[model samples]
Target: MRNKIKKWMRKVCFPISVTVCLLMIGMTVKAQESTSVKKGIFAGDIDLSGMSEAEARQAVTDYVEGLKETEITLLASGDTEVAVTAGDLGITWANPELVSEALEVGTRGNVIERYKVLKDLEHDNLVYPIQISFNLQMISDILLEKCVQYDVQAVDATLTRENGEFQVVEGKTGYTLDVETSIDKVNKFLTEEWDHTACTIALDVDVTEPRGKAEELAQVKDVLGTFTTSYASSGSNRSQNVSNGANLINGTLLYPGDEFSAYESVAPFTKANGYYMAGSYMNGKVVDSLGGGICQVSTTLYNAVLLAELEVTERFNHSMIVTYVDPSADAAIAEGSKDFKFVNNLEYPVYIEGSTSNKHITFTIYGKETRASDREVRYESKVLEVNQPPADIIYPDPGQPIGYIVYDSAHVGYKAQLWKVVLEGGKEVSRTQVNSSSYKMVPRSATVGTATADPAAYEEIMAAIGTGSVDHVKNVIAILTAQAQAPVESPEIGDE
Candidate 1:
């Protein structure tokens, strides 16, 4: 019985030992083959079977490089499209370790387990999907640089006047790229959603709707207020400036809560902008400057705006008194300093119509009238303080002859206020102060000449200027004129 048991043990133990030895040898072979990826393995569609780690890496890199030129189109409104490439977004292989991961596929487990894995690969591929990386900031930068050009800017609806009729101009919609969100979308598509082939992706875009539709602007038909100012006394150049400024401001449409800038509407003050040198008040004196008479246009618009009951956002009084409008009623705009701005506070849009005819500039504010027909409004100029001008001012002009003289009349200074009176059904209901102003007292100024060929006559004119009297200067000028006109002795000529 002992011998028979020994024989059975030997038979079992020998087979077990042989099997263990064969398993150890098989594992050793798999370890040796670990330098290369297992058979039937793939990185995406590129076959990596029996390929070394370096070769597999190179293959994957080549695949990524080949995909670098894939076309990606960015689209925007107005049929705007921009084409870009994957390389522009800084694409690269994300996981290089996956190549090594692929190499260890059948070599990692015990001999039987490794055999089972290799057997499984015979029927089903052992695919280590190719993962990629993208520079997110690079993607954003590309969209900003290349794709931003396709963005459309929203345009506001406006109005135009033709043949004394108001015409409506339509607005356009705008589209802009959403860069950050678009980057995320592109990254996700490339990493998980994309099939790694030539494909198109629509980027994230934002839509903007324009303001002031035609239906909204059609309500601006009733005339809310109107004002006119005369420029008959202005010279040809000054009158042209007035007309030019009025034309620039004509047919302007202002929606509710919109502010109008008088200076910005007609600016640059250059000859290119249709302005000419004309007289304007400066340093208590009249000086010639470009766009000099444009203040009259703003003043006219201001009165009309006041009558329309619009909100005044910014306003400035002129440095000196102006003859076109009463004190405390004028609006002035200067370069870099003063501006006249008003807001359309009503519920509907307002259309400004400006025109110049027969030496008069007129501004009319048209909008939907909400006030009762029985309501009446009027503006009154009130004088608070009167200041008399000082003695006449004299300036010497070296460019003119001794008898040449020019004078400017004095202007009296005043502290004045404008009042807005509202009446309902022929009864006064409200009286409010609209604005207040202070005018400087400018003395009568004279430019007198002292230039002469005769030193004696020049000295005489200087002496008259020292006396500070125009009569003295006139007397000296008369004497010089009489002397110059006196006939020379004729006896020499007769003898000849």
Candidate 2:
């Protein structure tokens, strides 16, 4: 019985000892993996086997930094190409946390499971793909700064008048980059398709065709509307300004659906732009200002546009009544505030021919005539209310002699409406209210002299000015003049 028991104990002890040794070996392997990544692991083709977390992170960082110099060629319209590096687009490592994930691999789960994963990685290495990040806006700005200059701009066909005939100047097509779409394409290629090396990308491009042709512009021979205004009363400077503004607007070509801006066509109202100091309206008063008579050019064009049956997009009435056109018939344009704009709504293009002759400025709009031969159109001004100016305004001037005075006549205010009367074969067909105007009443202004060596005369003139009456001021002037001119009486010779 003692021999049998000894044999049984020996068999049990042999198997139990082997199991304890294997458990201790497995714990030793897990402890080694806790300090560093497991063997047979990689981070984007970079082997990180048996490397510490810090070592693996550095390896991945270096890999990403090396990619910064990778060149990307951007091809744009017209055989244009721009070369850039990944650093220029703000590329950086996107997933540093992936390094930690690689370290944790085969470190989790029970001993048998961990052992199986490690064995599998021995034959098939685990790879964690390196992801990259970039600044989208940076890419966009780079493309705009480098690629925009290569884009070609489309040119619209224009018309020119020579020797009383119209000629058409052809236009050219253009090529331009589609920036937004190209940006998306670049991002997709870099993120999903690029192989961490140099590559070429074709930017999205757009084709723009020119407008109008020879046959289409040939229909602009007939005179659609013509208007003439007399600037004969204007001074030489004012007449020069009118003619200068007219020349700036001459030969302007307007295609169908194009809107013409009178102010834009003749702008930068400076001496360098052929403008002079002349009379223009300001706050219901006529003052000498630059680009003064330019309004007359716009007014004449406004009437011609009205007769042409064009669409007026914007129009403003003058602050004071002008002598060139009736009330509500004038169009006023001021710098930075007012503009006279009209659209060419006809089927064919129109040409603007402006000229100055015999102190008169005329604007003729030539286009294909579509109206009936017998049809006639005219505009009339109808007065609504008239406002009489108040008492005269007097200003004392100490610079001139006591009897000297300068005066300007008062302007009566008026409210009027313009009517567009269309007649077919000499019979009125329609009368439409075109526009309404309200002119401000400007009082008569007189600059009277109060300069006198006599204190009594100065005091008398001030008193007259306080009365706000031009007649009273004139009476004071007459009395003072008569006193000065009266013959002095000779003293009796016996008194001396």
Candidate 3:
């Protein structure tokens, strides 16, 4: 009976052993097939196994983000909803390496231990909750940035003088956000299961009382910079235009970041605009046009602004040299083609005072003087080149009597450099080149009609014009005198 039992056991044991070995081999092969962690696994209820690094990261992030939009309600006040977006309240993942940890869970220790971990992960469900906290300052910044629109900042009371007595101006009340309550609303949303989508918070306003009730304007007594230019040689129309333009700019107030436009301030230089026809440059010659001396006013203001160390935005020069200022110092303006502009870069407010006498136009700027008392500013005009004019052009007219000549103009061209010099305590501190101006030369011309009457006199006049007087206008009287003294030949051998 023992022998028979032994024989049956051997046969049954062999087959059973073969089946167990086959099952173990199959399980090992399945485990080894995947280099990464097995699937159907969860780290804190978030699936992370059997995925590439990028895929595992994405999966974990999605799970966290899904819980991020959870709504929080503020119930103390009425129903108001505030959605908590990502990065609000300084939202961030505590353990960002969770995916790496999940990958390593079944990978550490001995083979048996690793296999046991993998088996446990495959069989059981696990949830790992990460620690999330709010950053007080960062969250406050974000919340305040949004709340500023609802809250109005408190403004200080202003003072102004009117009717020779100081008047009281009522101060305005302002509103602000209750920061503590607002932060509470955000915390409740993050802590509780977001069921209600609305949150309510009331804005708290605080009264901002003014220091002084007089409401008197700031005492503006300092003269920041002032400039004056004489226009005594100007015609009646030109003088009117200058005065009109100056009047428009006078008593003008400018706050910070404000810009001044010469053309825009004084618009429509027509008869209706109190501007009359004056002599202005049309092409190359002077003609009767509207707003002739307006440019002079702008030029004067521009120089004053420069002296005050104000910022000049746009400026242009005339085609021909102006008689009022030096070459590059003058600022020319037309309605649409040209303009003069300056910006009020000072911290305090500024006012422009413009007044014109019959002899001069002046631009005085008033603002808080910030510069030192010892500092002085001046400009120097340096001549770089002298451009000689072209040859004289003579036009003969038969209507004129003998030896009659008209001298039109003598314009000398120049190339000059203007430097703005700053001095402190009689020492040169700095120098800035403002502009390089080029003036076009106008050639000297004379209409000598003596040739129609006397041949000898014509030769003498031509001889006088050709001599050493080639560069500039010289000896006009001498040439006329020489022509007068020339002897006329007798009406000789004409067989009449």
lDDT by residue for model 1 over 1-496, one digit each (tens)? 9999999999999999999987777865556565878778889899998898889999999999988998776664444677778888888998889898898887767677777787788899977788888889988888788777788888888888788677888998888888888889888887788776666777888888999878888887899999999999989999999999999998888888999999999998999999999988888878899988999999999999999999999999887788989899999999999999999899999999999999999999999999999999999999999889887777899999888988777889989999999999999999999998998888887889878899988888888888877667778889988998899976545554
Write the residue-wise lDDT of candidate 2 on 1-496 in tens digits: 9999999999999899988866875876566567688878888899998788899999999999999999989998776889999888888899999988998887788787777787788799988899998788988987899987799999888888989977788998888999999888888888888889998899888989999899899888999899999999999889999999999999988988999999999998899999999988887677889888999999999999999999999999988788888899999999989999999999999999999999999999999999999999999999898999999999989898899988766888999999999999999999999999998888988999988899998899999989988888989999999998999999777754
C-alpha RMSD for every candidate: 3.0, 5.6, 14.1
Poorly placed runs, candidate 3 (over 4 Å): 1-219, 396-408, 445-496
lDDT of 3 by residue, 1-496 (tens): 9999999999999999988876785577456545564565565656666777678777767766665564432222122234445445565566767666656666667556666666676678544455455566765675566554555555444433344333334555555556776666555555444332333434333434433233222534468888999999877888999999999888676656889998898888888888988877655456678888888989999888988788899988876778999878888888779899999898766668888986799998876788999999998888898878776666554576445666546567888888999999999999999988887777766665444456665555556555624322235435556667889988768667
TM-score of each: 0.90, 0.79, 0.49
Q: How far is candidate 1 from the true structure (C-alpha RMSD, Å)?
A: 3.0
**In model 1, which regions exceed 4 Å deviation?**
2-34, 109-124, 136-142, 396-401, 404-409, 451-456, 470-482, 485-489, 492-496
Better of 1 and 2 by lDDT: 2
Q: Which structure among the candidates has the greatest TM-score? A: 1
**Predictions ranked by lDDT, top down?**
2, 1, 3
Q: What's model 1's overall lDDT?
A: 0.87
